[model samples]
Target: MTSLVSTSHLQLAAFALGTVGWILCTFSMGMVEWRVWHVDNTTVISSGIAWVGIWKVCFISYLHISPGYKEQFCHKFSGYDSFIPREIYVAQGLLLIAMFVGLVGLTATVFALRNVYMGIAHKTLITRFFLVGGLCYIFAGLCVLIPVSWNFYSVAQNQSISFPPSYYMPTSPAAQDAGAAIPIGIVAVILLLLSGTFSLSYRFPVATNTTVNPDGINLPSAVSEQEQSQEIRTTSRVIL
Candidate 1:
């Protein structure tokens, strides 16, 4: 029992560290995409991306350090299998795809905004979509991690027998509890995909064209002709 408690404490520490690292990675990546690229600052973007990558490396390393033992140290403790179900792996793969898509969307939006300079509205829309998609990925990740944490707590508490004695047996209380999390993760992935689609759509004009002139000025045609004429007259008077 003492050994179990020690192991549980170690596992909990690892889970906490991994979660914090992942959160830092997510935040840094967002800063790279939003505050840096969206704001037309490449240096900050590069720095932020690098920082995120470092955090990701640390997160993965922590996962490796505590492999097969992460789910036995937190609330909702399920069992060992809950930490590494096939569905969880699939969800992780989907999250990677979503992350890639979001990064691509960010890059495209940044490039478009930088070159066009007048598509601020479009850029804003795309940025929002990317943000939503990224959040979906983050949420999905949480869903996966939660069950794993639960399983760790259960194992640490020596509650592995809460599951059926045999893996092939009918649904055990443990199995039922662990199974509940998979659907939530799937839902999150679906929402993320939908957000990614919306992000792509935002790249185009949804309404009337608000284009910029050669002088790099965005002109809304909704302005009255009289207003335009007055503006022209005012400019002429100023020049004279």
Candidate 2:
């Protein structure tokens, strides 16, 4: 007989799958945005952006809505979106703040990795690189969340408004400087790849062994008793 999955296990699995899908969708959106703005290809970029945006909205809505059923089946899931209904504006403001903070954190992580790779610090290079990459994708997700939450909160407050206008537009200078981040990201990735290559070449538990010879030792004879009456000499040497 096929084993039946419990409601809690099913909810957790759904959450895991949804999170993965959310990540992939956000990546697709980034590629679309980069091509549209950086490469100046409007047609394909526009279409890709629209498609990714629609899919992301639907996926998040499903996650938000499905918890209600899960709560009905299992009371533990009841409080997930409780604050969502009452604190819409506050939630949106917090989302924007998080997005800005994520952007700065990601940039800082990249710089930190650069320092490690340049021999400024003897730190674990791979860990720093992974941190930077993870933060990059996380910041990208925040980019998506800011607008989504803002629009949702607006709609919840006022149904008459179709959708909130974009709240996270890049300034002209920022848009111009966008190309610079790619080079930084590329350098971090290259450093990470080199660290991996080095790791693969090394064997574990390197050993060091040493030996000493007792035959080289000398002992003074009993004549030293009589010689003790004579003058003793001492010498010191210094090497520079």
Candidate 3:
């Protein structure tokens, strides 16, 4: 009997992890909390906290003229703002690229996994897809890793960005910390890395149909008895 082709459980696990990582990556990209700054004055800013992200900066504050109610305000980053730090600017570009690459990686993994479960005969092509997917995932993880590390270093040093006066934010935060997005991105990167390693582990299993001869040598069960006897006779003639 021919050996049965089957899906790799490791790659299936990899696909699950990569899918979760991709979702988290998307969330991290949109989240406006790469870094959080806490300020002393809550009278002007109700929340007394400011959020800075690759895409925008936001804070909750009372309307200056009508001070009874508070509202959240956000400023979207635009071309060439001196106030925005270079690290954030760099993160914007790199994270976007990472998201795209991760998407490609997920697509490739899906195709490979589907083909495997469907028992497609094109094993070589499926393996190539898995390799490409794994490489894409690793590259994507590295891309996110750069920005996450850069931002982490900045946070450890209490890096601050200057806001315009009209924004009503303090010149600098009393305290700053890395935000939810940073940790989320970090975890997502880890998952993607693991997924890449797992995806690369695809291998075909050896055939299970074998029997031990009287001499204790293992022989494939598919070998005909007539062929085995003929081989044994030939070997005996050679020995004589």
Candidate 4:
């Protein structure tokens, strides 16, 4: 007989994890605040504290004289920071695209699970559809990964030493670290990959009974022709 319980749990788990990753990635993409790290300025009056994101940047002042948030302002990319790291832009676009693609994948997976009992043909169709959706998840993860990775590297290099000269860096003494979004994106990638692998690993259950149908054929006959011939010869010898 056929059973869905065995693999259903695993598939559902993978789907749930992938969905969580998707939500995190979406949040990260839209979030334009809280960068990996900011310049560690000693003086309270000094304005080095900043929160940066892929789409926008901001400067926060926490001067000692006016502690408790006297004034804080957020600003968008003004197209003034050197040549503007193109990687961020690319990442932004990719993440957005991934979100949409992942949506389609999730939809396919849900429907595929539902149609599992529609016979071998339907099951095969579901398997293929799920695989395609998994591919989309993977692609979307990659899209999120590229930009996050590039940004992390760029920030590290800039913070480590003056490679592109002083002007290229974000002000001076600005330390860098991995942002929250980076990890979120990484998690999403892992989940997406797992979801895809699950889809590919799905195996159609086999039955010992033979069935003859145009669209269906139970593989591996119960007894091969050679085995049948040998059995017949043994029977004749026993009768004699």
Candidate 5:
């Protein structure tokens, strides 16, 4: 006779936290206008003149779309009209893969919940499911982190070593800075790490020794009459 399983507070909390981190990480992926330039060079003084993202980069509307303030306007980049950079392409692929793995992790987490299954066999299965989910999240975190960190490092004036001649990073005034998405990705990675760690360490199936009756009497209070009589006699003998 199977019954509804109860989920512990710890299990629910970890799942919620992990899901939140995944959402934030995905949101950060779409935020563009990264690596904008703020130059005080004698030749130019442009502010927020470009838009860069993991997937694409474009110059802000320089013509009369929503003119006056270029910083307030954005233009769409296309494969036919604009040349896309290689690093951005790499970033896009890795970030997409990260999101895909995170989706798998979320799916596994659903089955890992205590209320989802209630047998000894299921107990072990759920634990393994959660363990796999946690590892996937860790992988997802690394995937996003790699691109974000690499992009930042590539542009950092003090830290940049020369890029290979074939895969050379272009010297753009815009490359001198980071973007809004950078901090957001950083926070997401931290949350994912914490959430996965907590999920991995959680102890479910707190009780290991569960006694079930062989005669279809599953209730703990329902024992054999002979056993009850023996228990009573043993109590009387102790009293005497």
Candidate 6:
């Protein structure tokens, strides 16, 4: 006999967390503040603050040409730019892959939950979907976690990056710190991990097909139990 299992509340919570995490991950990736630099140089680009991300670098000068005028500029990382650090390059690639994988996991989770709630598929098949989605979410979280941790470590070690003349960024900064994006990415990874764990916790409920006849006579084996289950499910839906 087939049985339709209701979706678990924990799975719903996992989906919500995973969705939020994926969005935050994408936001962090696009933000150009992975690392912050403050420059005190007065000769060129005076009172400048720079933001370096995996994809690009941006700079803002409060007192560049005139005290009343503010200057802001950004430069994208070129494919052949050797000046970019290894960690940043790795972050760029890994974060992109993470976004793609997270998207896939989110899609899988949606479909799996829909199937379970609607009783569109057998519990075994739906469970497989949940497992795949959970694995994908975990893998994506790991991919992003590696880059975020690596870059954060580099910042802690006082890493520096050289900029071309056009970018007008100082090779060294008076003060350097990890930017907002770093913490955001870390939080996103944590959420994704929790989501995957919760999703994986889902288990199928036990089912039994044994039916006793009131006449103390066994039902004929020629009658399919699955058909009866389907008929009962249809009748229940109609009554509801």
State TM-scores per candidate: 0.27, 0.24, 0.83, 0.72, 0.65, 0.81
Model 4 lowest lDDT segment of ten? 160-169
Off by over 4 Å in 5: 1-7, 39-48, 65-86, 114-121, 158-171, 206-240
lDDT of 4: 0.66
Checking candidate 1 for backbone clashes, the offending pairs are 71-151, 71-152, 71-153, 72-151, 72-152, 72-153, 73-152, 73-153, 74-153, 77-150
Quote the lDDT for 196 in model 1. Answer: 35
Worst 10 residues of 5 by lDDT: 160-169
Q: How accurate is candidate 3 locally (lDDT)?
A: 0.83
- Residues 1-240, model 1: lDDT tens digits: 112222223223322333333343234322211100111222212221111110111111112223364311111212344533443344345445444544444444344334334434443654464445445434434543443344334434433232232221112212212222333333433443343343333333335556565799988867877987899899999999
Per-residue alpha-carbon lDDT of model 4 for 1-240, expressed as tens digits? 557545556666657866887887788887764254456653432465555677765455554233354555444554455445677668768888989988887887777777764333455676777787678777777877788788778767754322133222244445666777777777888888787777666775655566463558654566677886898899999999
* Off by more than 4 A, model 2: 1-91, 129-133, 136-143, 146-158, 161-240
Per-residue lDDT of model 2, residues 1-240, tens digit only: 111122123222322333343333333333312111222322322212111121111111111223454211111112333322333343344434433543444444445444433544323543454344445434434444444444344333432212212211111111121222223223323333332232222221222433333576443443454453442322222221
Model 1 stretches with alpha carbons more than 4 Å out: 1-83, 118-191, 199-240
Candidate closest to the true structure, highest TM-score? 3
Cα misplacement distance, residue 214 of candidate 4 (Å)? 29
Ranking by lDDT: 3, 6, 4, 5, 1, 2
As a whole number from 0 to 100, the lDDT of residue 217 in candidate 5 is 55
Clashes of 5: 0
- lDDT, candidate 6, 54-122, per-residue tens: 898877555454344467656789889999999998988999998999999898888888887786756
Q: Write candidate 5's Cα lDDT for 1-240 as tens digits.
A: 333244445556667877887887889889884455543332222343444565544443333434475434444444443355555666777788888988888787777774354444466777787788788888888888887787777557522222223211233553357888877888778877776776687555443333455676554544667996898899999999
Model 6, C-alpha of 7: deviation from truth (Å): 4.7
Candidate 4 wrongly placed segments (more than 4 Å): 33-37, 40-47, 62-70, 78-82, 117-121, 159-173, 210-240
Give Cα-based local distance difference scores for all models: 0.35, 0.32, 0.83, 0.66, 0.64, 0.83
